[model samples]
Target: MDVTVAIDCMGGDHGAVVTVPATRGFLRSHPRAKAVLVGRPEALEQAKGEFGDEFGDRLNFQVAAEVVDMDESPVSAMKNKKDSSMRVAIELVKSGRADAAVSAGNTGALMAISRFVLKMLPDIDRPAIASALPTMKGRSYVLDLGANVDCSAAHLLQFGVMGAMLVAAIEHTDRPTVGLLNIGEEAIKGNEVVKQAGELLRASGLNFVGNVEGDDIYKGASDVVVCDGFVGNVALKTSEGLAQMLASFLREEFGRGLLSKCAALVALPVLKRFKRRVDHRIYNGAVLLGLRGVVVKSHGSADAFAFEQAIYRAAEAASNQLIERIGERMAAMDGVQQA
Candidate 1:
């Protein structure tokens, strides 16, 4: 596997402190993997200082000269900050200097810069950010996670196909089930767009599971859930918030009394595992699907471990040649012929 990852050293909240160590950790585990750290030379030097020779050989540095601010408008950043870290890292992938690009920066800006720098896959109309959600059974993927807010039925159907391909490749789920996120599971429930998308998916010759209600997400009824960015983003955020609230509530209950503390002690290991399973940080990376190259987005607040997972995810995506697979699938589908 050509596991080379380009990381924006200036992308996250903690900047180089997080990126540098995470790169070191990733290289430590993957001796053959290469990491190109992109950002201001001075900051990257200081951050890269922590690793010394361990990452010195496998690591290369690119001076981005600028950064795309988290609050800046996505289009403005793309138009104005041509030399930003986000743009530079994406350029590496486009130029074949790196196999994948990983960033823990502004989601909107990253998407914008990636679209501008690396371009989209041939048959893709718009790129979607696909994230894996760990379910009771295992892991499932949700697509258009805040990438394209308003989507047509065709867009949602395409998302399902791409998402199914992704999970099948990475998660080893052959014939991964696809479902359209809707208000209800019934065939005639949602508005016209969803109804049309559902019909398209069911007839697309893929493993379509019909419609899936929001509440059924964690139940793992489907392996790939497709929706417009607006609905998918709301569901993602709601799940994260609810998980936090429940963990806090459980801890509070454990602190209530001596008997409660004793019970909590007995269940502490199980609770810890549950907390780890539900933490958003544990599932820190999202793939910018439909891009010409692999681009993984890490949460802005991610720490070293989260960054490590992002690196691993990027490596897996690149090794799998996700974009190439998508192109092949599109070529085979007469309706969505490769662009």
Candidate 2:
């Protein structure tokens, strides 16, 4: 199926410098996909020049009047920057011109504008940021990364429902297991809210696998992990920091002396494999689940390669009909409730 993605060319730290090249690279691999580049006409023209006719008609452009600054508050940006690249790109999806939208912009601004433009899915109170994380058993999806800092037990239950449906659509899993992030494995261990969320998950007809701790995330105890935005953001940032620190330490140790350098040369192949396994760029896209339309958020500081991964992820989700699948799952749940 042909998938169309709206690109916010002026959203990230590097703006068109990164997004344009990333879109080109993504199109090279995904021939069935098309991109609508949204940004200033001058910048988009420059990007078009760089690609020449290689992209053919697969790549197009739209002019956006303004740009949203990284430090701007979400509410202020939403109110003041109506024609901003980020908002314009998302608007393409709302207008049925794009199957999905990808932006490496301010997370808050993206979320706020997206919610304002696309609204929420039926039976979905709020949307959550859901992303994949590397795990020993491959990878797992985690939700509420930073969208809703204060989520209710009911909200968490909705996240589990949306996340499981997402995994089922993208990974083709019949019944992906969902785990509630908690202090302990026992059902009664967490705070009242978490305990209540657990109770709901256990009875919600989902593949509830009980509560899992921090260690269980990388251990791959479940296919989906659920938590409020605050905890999820902390966990995500901490993992990123640890990965960077480990890489720095390894570099320092490898250059310690001639002997260490020689050992590093001998182990270069193994080290490369290890780096690929843990590379965050391979998982650059975070889906804003429960939105009426498809929206993807790329890491703001991502480079061309990393941003390309985000585009690839957006195309996959669109082609797989992720939004429709989530609706069907929720509809089934409603049927059970009405029974």
Candidate 3:
């Protein structure tokens, strides 16, 4: 297998500056893989300049007249920006022209285009963006990062099943544990949605591990944490901000004086490694679960390396039969009727 990936060449902060080089680097490492770079023809040409003969021969591009802006609303933008690169790239996957699609664009627009073009898997009410977060214990899957803001208890149960399947398949875990995002670990805690969803998940025959609090996200209390998009997105952004703040605080503390500076020099490598582990960009991107095809969302400000990581994550999603597995799991759940 040669997996074909479609990159939204014009849809990120860095545009093709990051996408083109990332494609080049991915192809260099994954010789069997191919890419369809979707964007305005001239912008892609300029970005393609860096790869010279190597990429000129290996790559392909599909022209899309427009690029989705970062600030656009999901539903309205997808309806209006039909010629957008994100829309075209997702269309490629839906049409079987590409095995997967990757983008660092407007999260809302990407999710909308994905739902419109690729549709959801059988029995899935809404697709979700699931990310692998590095934990002190290791890593865990957190779903509905920004996909469905208003979710039902049934939806959270679906997330648990699908997310568990994702971690088990892609991460090579056997019977990955599942948890509900809540204010406390007690079964009686959380809002009505969490409490009701907890009941469903506990009875759903999956490996449900009760509830986990916000602090447990990186403590590895569970392999999969299920929540609605609104909460998950807040948690994700808060984690990112905290990670950056902590890194900056450490740097400032160490650079205060000569003795501290000397200690900082000695600790630089370890600190840098730790920072990389916490930065979500290092983990970079994740697959949008419950869709008919693999769709990955990279960091909006992703660089070439980050884009490359996103591509790799997309490939893993495809190879693991993520869509198929999620469908099977959701179908097995008692409440979700197969459509």
Compare the candidates by lDDT and give the number of the best one: 2
Better of 2 and 3 by TM-score: 2
Q: Which stretches of candidate 2 lie over 4 Å from their true place?
A: 185-188, 335-339
What tens digits encode model 1's per-residue C-alpha lDDT throughout 283-321?
Answer: 889999988899999998899989888888989888887
Better of 1 and 2 by lDDT: 2
Q: What value of lDDT does candidate 1 attain over all alpha carbons? A: 0.85
Judge candidate 1 at residue 317 and give its lDDT.
80
> Which residue pairs collide, candidate 3?
none
Q: Per-residue lDDT tens digits of candidate 2, residues 1-339?
A: 499999999988899889988998899998888999999889988988998999788888999999999989999999899999999999999999999999999999999999999999998898999999989997899999988899888899899998998888777788999999999745558899998898888888999999999999999999999999999999999999998999999999999999999999999999999998888998999999999888999999999999999988888888889999888888878854333
Candidate 3 residue lDDT tens string, 136-227:
89899898898889999888888898899888767878889999999964564788988889888888888899989999988999999999
Error of 2 at 160 (Å): 0.4
RMSD of each: 2.2, 1.7, 2.4
Q: CA shift at 177, candidate 3, in angstroms?
A: 1.3
User: For each candidate, what TM-score against the reference?
Assistant: 0.94, 0.96, 0.92
Name the better of 1 and 2 by TM-score. 2
